[model samples]
Target: MDKSGNMIDKMLTQNGLVYKIPNKVAAKQGPAFLQKQRSGSVAYTQGVAAEQQACHWLEQDGWTVLLRRARTHRGEIDIVASKAAVLCFVEVKKRRSIEEALVSLQPAQQRRLFRAAECLLQKHPYWQYEEMRFDLFVFDNAGKMERLEDILRQM
Candidate 1:
């Protein structure tokens, strides 16, 4: 590999293009899908961008964000934020319209978020003092934001 990396050898004989790619793990990422970094998918990129937009929207509304993409073995929290001593475990949904986004947080995902939040609080005791609630930050395709505050668990 070192001999191949030597520019002198490449300059002497060029049957193919010279490209040396680095082998490094992805930084600041959730676990790789199927153990591979499938980074170019449009849906994944849009979802990430939606989460970032949700963060900005929360900040503008006087919410103090504590964490972005907090993960547990079971699931991930999109944003952990607080305002007026009330901590919110936020789940963000992005869709073609605000109404569509509102309906996107399915019951199964809600359960996962709640379970993840419980696990996270157990590990980090300091947040336990604050009153915790579930919220949904819904965004449309055009980047408009809406809030569904204190989502109730479906019975």
Candidate 2:
């Protein structure tokens, strides 16, 4: 038994029933682990909300959203949208300031996004387009939004 009065190991009963035990390490971590999990959940929810807003903005601009939160072996693509013959892989970032959000997407992450886009194209051959580009959509906590088109072209 640990300090919390919980059994740290499995207990066997005379009636041939075995009681499952909690992990001692996890039990010991307790509140700290739970706090981390809660923060992670909050971040995930915020990310989803940002992606939804990005999709809405795209639709307003005559773009059709093909996929939201598209997952590949490389990484996740926030939004895949098409307008006419152009296809865009958009990366959404939300931060306290536009500069902060823009800087959050580093070069390594850009490489991952490129690889993820390739993986997605391979998986969905029907997403063909005459032109494809990478874009960055940033939102600051002040409700300001900005779109940087052909983000990789400048790289």
Candidate 3:
């Protein structure tokens, strides 16, 4: 309908209906703000869904999950759980395959997770937990979860 012969688009707003220029122009002219917003929303939702799945699996295994998305200056621990008398700091990595998930936690990530566990211990002095362990939950592309090694003493 415009001079370029492309159909003009309309978007609804609380104020009223308004015309929106085609996305090609803005995407080509400057930063893709809309795309970034959409991508961020998608990533956040995916993370939450994965955490929920991990929590469900942990509960089914008789672990009392205390917290999720636990963050510190070091990094974010996906889930914190207590089983028997031990405290567990968990790192969850989701990938398309077992090999991908195994390789997901690089050396740098391991260091961050280590620091986060120390921070957790510092925060909860009353925990008096006899054992502390770092565990990894690997989720495949189909959303199947499996427990890998408990990399506590390895540190």
Candidate 4:
């Protein structure tokens, strides 16, 4: 059981699924579904990798990570972190530039973030904190984190 878990863990760690290529020859024949399928697969893999990195970064900074890739009816919160007395809900954007990163967040995305946070609060009322806020994490194409901004404080 431990060995199976370890194998799954290794397969899950990093964006290992991104390397999986679809049958391009099959795609060319008719529907071209393989291309879209591969793209979606890669996206899911990248999202997992980004979530893992965000959790690791928060933990390194001394915050206890509560969750990663937390989902609600509205949308997903990439990371949930707590320390001292604050609960931070995070959205991670991975891009090639700062502009691209910021552009990734739209008004609809903000609404989803708020709804997800509210859902979390409802579920975990015992998790007391002096404050709660939504945060944005920007990661460059090289997998380096460039910025972390608290969007809640601004609003």
Please say which candidate is ahead in TM-score: 2 or 3. 2
The sequence of per-residue lDDT tens digits that candidate 3 reaches over residues 69-153 is 9899988899999989988888887777867887888988888888887897788777757888888887777877778657755
Poorly placed runs, candidate 1 (over 4 Å):
1-40
Q: Arrange candidates by TM-score, highest first: which order? A: 2, 4, 3, 1
Model 1 per-residue lDDT tens digits across residues 20-64: 443232222324542455644666788899889888888998988
Ranking by lDDT: 2, 3, 1, 4
Reference-based TM-score of each model: 0.69, 0.82, 0.72, 0.74
**Model 4 worst lDDT run, 10 consecutive residues:** 1-10
lDDT of 4 at 145: 75
Per-candidate clashes, comma-separated: 0, 0, 0, 0
Task: Give the better candidate number (3 or 4) by lDDT.
Answer: 3
Candidate 3 residue-wise lDDT at 118: 82
* Pairs that collide, model 2: none
- The lDDT, on a scale of 0 to 1, for candidate 1 is 0.78
TM-score for model 2?
A: 0.82
Q: Pick by TM-score: which candidate is best? A: 2
lDDT of 4 by residue, 84-149 (tens): 998999888877776788789998888888888889889888898998877788777777776555
TM-score result, candidate 3: 0.72
lDDT of each: 0.78, 0.88, 0.78, 0.76
